[model samples]
Target: MVVQNATENSIKIMKNLKLKIRKTILIVFVSFFSIFSTYAQFDGVFSHYMHNLSLVNPSYAGENNMIQASLFQRTQWIGMPGAPIMSVLSVDTPFKLLERQHGVGVQFLSDIFGVFNNQQVKLLYAYKYKLGKGHFSFATNIGMINVICNADSINISKLTTDDGYHSDNDPAIPIGKQTGVGFDLGFGLNYVSDTYSLGASLTHVNSPIISIGDKNEFNVLPLMQVNGAYRFPLDRDNGKYKINTNVLFLTDFAVWTSHLSSILEINEKYWAGVGYRYQDSFSIQFGLELFDGFRLGYNFDIPSNRLILNTFGSHEVFATYEFSLVRQKSNSTKSIRIL
Candidate 1:
């Protein structure tokens, strides 16, 4: 009789455990959906955007007319549970085809937020031409995104309960993983010259539907961005000392954000800057030309908003490498005595 009573008690505890797990799952999903549904769609944010412009603007691909590659990683809201972490890889090169200058690129990215995950791949193409004393570019991108939710990550065995029965396969709880895939499209335009650059882009123009569950579908909304940068010579020391001012504006129709920053370059090797995001955060930036063709950059963001109370801050680090084709060609020609 004691053995049977113990068995009954165990069953009761198991049932209560299952009940609490179900309730927790419900609350988590409700909170996530409630936060996301009010916005156009969830998009990753970056602090080192200038170094990774191709992530936001397709027209930026091959803008420097060189074979260039960049990698970026960002950790947002450190010390906050379920904060976002993202990474991106992008490469592009200038090419001549059909007697026209063009740019081609490929990009891959992975993002994780709490229990949600997103992976994406994109192909970018840009047409280049001359306008006035500057150059103009128009670009388009095609991509696919896979969205997922992993409910198995939750801890269920730790719960305690006194109920008499337990259903481990509760239908109300998402016990496994759910995923959906969708197509994405983007457009961008850029104009650049010796002194300045300007760009505008629109992403997710199609509003693709990502169906995580049979009954749950999210329509990715369009995001718009406009950016501009100007370079001013501070002193005429072989163009060593100069200040670059940049502004970026982003909007997803419902919410908007802006970044205004400036960098002082020294001897074409070192740079440092500071920035402010309206009602969002303050940022510090630093970069180095590590070698002839390699560069490294870092940005630290401190929350000036309410989020500071719950989290420490955010960090972004990126690196870039460029193939100096112009110098390579010049050397090749000179080596053969053709020049």
Candidate 2:
């Protein structure tokens, strides 16, 4: 009889535990979808796919055959006043020796809006792995984020009402600008098979609290990202004719709400794609590279929801160059040099 009673008690406890877990999950999901459903702080930052390669993941470093250098920029919520603008510069190189290959890389990132801006410098360490005929790598990154933020110059007139901005006369508002320090760590797994590749990464593990006084400690973020690309061969026997499409999906459960983009590249020289975002609006991008050495790109944003359109859709442009190239040898020894 005692054993029977104990069994009943155990079963009741298990049932209660299950109920609590379900409730917690439901509440979390609802909270996640609601908080970022409207205007968001970081929504404008991840509006384009190109920016992800340079700023979000260290695994993106030096995955290709040659040393790679890139620059990307984005202006969110085209036509919206006080929208955010972002820029990044990155360089990565692979080392090949003893039939094994690995790479190292670095990047610089800047994000600005209203009177605030954030700058980050990152270092990447990568380990190479072979897949079929091609090779790829998984990498880890560490960064120093120098947050040069100035809340004093916020230009309250431009911010208007209810977007989480307090009036200049508000007690919480400070009269002077302040600086903060933070750090970030990232891990990514990359793979390239045949003419296609895929990768996933988690970035910004150090989540710092940027607010004054530390009354409520808020960890800035930890993000999850997945990226993929495929290269297509065009025409018969046209060795130089090829097209590539790259897609990047991003989300930070805390802030973004929704951030995703798909970019299509036509041949090695040109690319164009469209993006959808809930925080601010939709974005379109176009880019071109000449002789695989000089690169240039542009993005256009159009406001989505109501009211924000009065400001204007934003425009951004970027330029990049590769100062050097690597040539692969065909294992030929020049006996003809004897002549």
Candidate 3:
């Protein structure tokens, strides 16, 4: 495909660009890690790669030409007290009406962080347009997010005895739980051809205002995820080998930023790969594509730097299923999922 060829050529250019941008990366990393350790924050990563249909790019919803459902679970820094537990369930499908291709998606997500919890329900809508024999799609998602904080997790003894709020019966901290509501908006663009695809997205547009406790003063930062991926087939047809690579950069308004991760995947019934996360993390992922286009994937993040000293590795699992309603000759995307 022309897109594939162009990207291959562009990689050489990008490699150079990466080097030239060293100062930005270094500054971002230093600013990020320094603030990461000092925060009592919500867990990120509830939406993993597969469930990322809309999270990755709004236009990516239903890119595979079928109604799809995906779910993901991630437990970060296992064995560590107060580790994060998160999950996301997503469904998306494509349809044609009046000669227009449209996609819709809905997601339910929940994340728990120490004493804090967040639940969100989102709706996504996308439209597809043809561009020089390829399909270009753009989409937007808007929904509501609810946050809950459990005061029971706080230790009264841990606080300094002060008349300001040291009393366990103090009204500011809220002895039980508190709740708040907010809204979110996200948008994405995707370009998909016969052999390759690329996408970009921006999430958390409204910057939800959630004040969990009476005394807590800080607000949560609106997060961002910028990612792109490419696939290279070794041959034009009947290819036994192919490489899928991707890069993801995540940042918050605060100093916490994850040094983007690079992922490489090999396609087959059973595949294995590894990823290196620059923010002191590493991951190895494996997957199996079973019958009826069902897929199961897993990844383990190896602790690095200071994190390794406090906890065991992190683990994640993903599952997805997609099938055609009618027995029509399927396209490349459908074929790959079936395998």
Candidate whose TM-score is highest: 1
**Count of steric clashes across candidates, in order:** 1, 8, 0
TM-score comparison, 2 vs 3, better candidate: 3
Give the Å shift of residue 323 in candidate 1: 1.2
Q: Which ten residues in a row have the lowest lDDT in candidate 2?
A: 330-339
Q: Which digits, one per residue and each the tens of the lDDT, describe model 3 over residues 182-298? A: 777878887776555666677776655665556543444555666655566666486566665656666665544443333344455566666666665788877777866788888
Cα lDDT, all candidates: 0.78, 0.59, 0.65
Report the lDDT tens digits of candidate 1 across residue range 1-339. Answer: 999999999999997777777666656655665454444274776767776577778997877667888899999899987777899999988888888889899999988877778888999999999899888999999999898878667653333133223344444434568788999999999888778888999999998888776666778889899988888779876777878888889888878888888888786678898989889899998989788657898999999999999988999998988775555544221000000
Candidate 2 Cα errors over 4 Å, as ranges? 1-54, 97-99, 154-171, 211-217, 234-236, 239-243, 255-267, 277-280, 323-339
Ordered from best to worst TM-score, the candidate numbers read 1, 3, 2
lDDT for model 1, please.
0.78
Q: What is the lDDT for 259 in model 2?
A: 43
List the candidates' TM-scores in order. Answer: 0.84, 0.69, 0.77
lDDT of 2 by residue, 1-339 (tens): 999999999999996776565555434423432332221223234444443354555665655545667677776555543446777777877677777777788888777654456677889978887767756678899887655436555443333333332343553333346555666787887776656667788777665454432221124577777777676666547635555555666677654444445665554567677776565568788778665456677777676766453756777776665543546474221110000
